[model samples]
Target: MGKPTGFIEYLRELPVDRTPTERVKDWKEFHHHMEEKKLRQQGARCMDCGIPFCHTGKLISGMASGCPINNLIPEWNDLVYRGLWHEALDRLHKTNNFPDFTGRVCPAPCEGSCVLGLNNPPVTIKNIEAAIIDRGWEEGWVVPEPPAVRTGKKVAVIGSGPAGLSCAAQLNKAGHSVTVFERADRPGGLLMYGIPNMKLDKKEVVLRRIKQMEQEGIKFICNANVGDNVEPQIFLKEYDATVICTGATQPRDLPIEGRQLKGVYFAMEFLGANTKAVLDGGAEHALISAQKKDVVVIGGGDTGTDCVGTSMRHGCKSLVQIEILPKPPTERAADNPWPEWPKVYKMDYGQEEAAAKFGADPRVYLTTVKKFVGDEQGHVKELVTVEIKWEKNEKGQFIPKEQPGTEQTRPAQLVLLAMGFLGPEQALLKEIGVETDPRSNIKAEHEKYTTSIKGVFAAGDCRRGQSLVVWAINEGRGAARECDRYLMGYTDLP
Candidate 1:
């Protein structure tokens, strides 16, 4: 422990965010870093508890409770408090291959399970983590560490998202020649396209890491869709082992009336096209602008929140978000206790900006859209919605029951569906002959990570269904270790 009484002496502090009005004008990241001295003070708040539940990486009540990649939270915090940033970065990289991505996007289950958070605020672990990695980049501490000896084994990773990148990185470190295939024109999957640039700078952060991985001998082939452009049988014939990490990209659809309106689009379609256009020298083509339009985003999740933020940047005239589920409590309910991720309401960046501009949060809970009303031009003009109540049907399945006299019509120029993904697209999996679970996810044991076919493994969203980036990294590393074991009949990777 850097200071035995540090937790008692210091309260948690975090980086400040740019003001709503100012940040909404640009697509750059809005988070401002704290001073080095104050950041050290925040790191000092780590109590170094005897158990240190923050890094346990366990699941409780079906939700993650700590760092999913098992980062050495206390050790890194102590190092940061003592101004040992390079050492802190080294320790942070020991488990997590990409702390920058998780630091920005993760919900921070570690903070929820922090020993200090039982009473006071939790240690600024995520902030400290981002600081360490950013410092490492600035100081030129991060570099390619290619394995010394070649194993003469080649592996194919069929995705370029966090999971695929992590798997390829680890396998390369184990002296295996690894090649990653991405169907998109660019790599990084959702990290490159699904996410907006303001949240994660594409060139500065993500592509920098990609360059380093390439230098470390990991090959990334873009615009190659296995089972389509590149034959799946060719991979099985050429590579010694194949690891599938294609993320859950299949979007859920709203099958209501007037669904085919020109102005309506899937959340990914809007976000992806906008990002691609931004990256293409700010081209007008493939861009979805919300300027002077009334926008309605369906579903209440991260993707929905991203839509809210993105629309605000486009100078939308009005915005409304609808959620079928009831609003969460402001505080943890009696059913949700300590050490579990709390199901409570919090204003994310998008809602914060919307509230600042519109005078209230834009989300309306327990509301279901019945149809997208369109004009003579075939563009969506309004949304017909009704309040709903959850009731158990004869089969005991909870279904939405429309409440009487609760119907309303709201004006809208654009509607984005963000209800989440179904599963990985089935074309590649079917061509590869991998079995899928009942949920349509690729069948693979969590620990072994082996598919029904020998020499083939699966991980990440494709294997585990839609999940967070941290879980994807965890499964990727686990699958890499298992692949190594299968190649050598034993392995040393953790």
Candidate 2:
């Protein structure tokens, strides 16, 4: 530890963000950077516990409890606390290939499981991480380190999202020739499209990294969809190994009445189109503008929150997010103890922005849209909703029972389906002859990352179903290590 009593002496602190009203006007990052001195103070808050659960990367109750990439949290925390930023950056990059991405978007289970959090607030590990990387970029310390010699073994990675990028980077470092294929016009799959620009700036942050990777000798091919635009057999014929990192992009649909309404759209379609428009000179052809519209977003997850934020950016007249599940307690429930992820109610950035714009938070708990009410032109104009209560059915299965007299109709001009993803589309997997689990995810064991087809591996959302970006990166790194091992007799990759 940098300071023996650092945990006791200092408290947790995070960087300030721009006001919601000020940030909504443009597509730029809202977070303000902290001064170096203040960052050191935040870093000093790291207890770096004897049994650091933050780096364990274990699963409890089917939820990730710590850094899934097994980041060397304690070592880097100490380095930052001592003001040895270059050393901190080195340690941070030792495990995570992209601290910049995780530092901004990750929910930070590390802080949730922090030993200091047992009594006081946890250390600002995530902010310190971002600071280290940003500093590395400013100082020009981060440079391309291509492998001294190539192994002459070729590998193809499908999808240029976090998983595919990390896998390709690691494999390239291991001296294998790696190429990434992206279906989108640009690389970074969901990173470049599914995610809104305000949360993660595309040019300043994401593309900067991609440019660096290009310099590192990793080849990226855009507008290439295996089994569609490009033949699947070409990979098998050309490359020694293939790793599929295609994310779980097949969105789950809400099969309710008036689903064919014109104003109704999938969350991905809206977000993707918006990003594409923003990148294409800030104007869209089929503009799905929320301006002056009463927007209702179905499903209260990250995607729903993103829709809420995006709607606010478009100057929506009003907004509401419907969640079927009951609201979580303000604090952990009796059954949920510390070190387990705190199942408490918290306002995300989008909700915070919505609350600032409106008088209250937009979420309606224990409610779901029964149907969409559309005008004569088949444009969604309202939503018919009903409150529901959970009860055990005859077969002992939990079912949502509609509460009588709770039916109501609310004004809505636009309805966004933020229900979530089902799994990877089956067509490509079928064409490639890869086995799938009962869940329809590519059949690959955790850590091993091997498909039923030899010399072919699967990882990320496609292999493990819908998951966090951190988990995807973990899967990518693990899959790369396994792929490298398969390429050679043994491997030294970690």
- lDDT of all predictions, in order shown? 0.92, 0.89
lDDT of 2 at 362: 93
Using all chains and alpha carbons, the TM-scores for the candidates as numbered come to: 0.98, 0.98
Point out the worst 10-residue segment of candidate 2 by lDDT: 278-287
Error of 1 at 34 (Å): 0.8
Model 2 regions lying over 4 Å from their true place: 283-286
Score residue 412 of candidate 1 by CA lDDT. 93
* Model 1 regions lying over 4 Å from their true place: 283-285, 394-397
Q: Compared to the true structure, candidate 2 yields what TM-score?
A: 0.98
